[model samples]
Target: METRIFFNPGDSIANIHDYNEAVRQGQIFKRERHSDDLVIAKGPGDEEYAIFYAKDAVKNPGKGQKPYDVKNTL
Candidate 1:
């Protein structure tokens, strides 16, 4: 049996028994998004929890191609 470990961004600990069990049983599927990796897990009462990982770092917004001013506007 291959032990697949998934990291939950919300929780620092990696060994979440419930999540591991769910994944092992194919109840939940891990999906990756453009900005971050997502762990989609099914919760009780038809509720779902999405845990995001590897969040994009905050970047400084540089000057735009065109200056923002009344004169620059055409």
Candidate 2:
């Protein structure tokens, strides 16, 4: 099964490890990859953002690897 990971800004209490752990622990919200891109819903009254990872995103997590803007094609 394909799984999708989600991270929120400033959801970490400690370092980056803790941040990821928090995400794994449900401190942040996440959902499985149901389509080409995941349509994420933000907090109440907030705008929605789509998170997507290219095929090589896992190989390269740095900039230029993932699509920052959902509307723009990667």
Candidate 3:
């Protein structure tokens, strides 16, 4: 499985809602929110994507060997 991340400088809630709608409309496979700053969505294929939100910026978790941790920040 391959994973990717996307950043959107918009309301996290709205973003999540959009993903949920997509899932409902059969546009995506699944979408989930791990935290206030993290949301995960899966595509029809083997692709997984995530969206990470920070105060004024949106960040992608990016490809990593393991799940990115959002609790600890410097």
- Highest lDDT model number: 3
Per residue, candidate 2 scores C-alpha lDDT tens digits across 1-74 of: 33333334223222222323433433233343232422222222233333322232243234333322222212
Give lDDT tens digits, candidate 1, residues 17-71: 3544534323233322223343333322223332323232112323331111110
Worst 10-residue lDDT window for candidate 2 reads 65-74
| Alpha-carbon RMSD, each predicted model | 19.0, 13.1, 11.9
Could you give candidate 3's per-residue lDDT for residues 1-74 as a string of tens digits? 43343334233232233444533433222234333433444322323332334342324443332332232111
Worst 10 residues of 1 by lDDT: 65-74
- The parts of candidate 2 lying over 4 Å away from their true place are 1-46, 51-60, 65-74
Flag the better candidate by lDDT, 1 or 2. 2
> Each candidate's TM vs. the true structure?
0.19, 0.16, 0.19
Residue pairs with clashing backbones, model 2: none
Residue pair clashes in candidate 3: none
Please count the clashing residue pairs in each candidate, in the order shown. 0, 0, 0
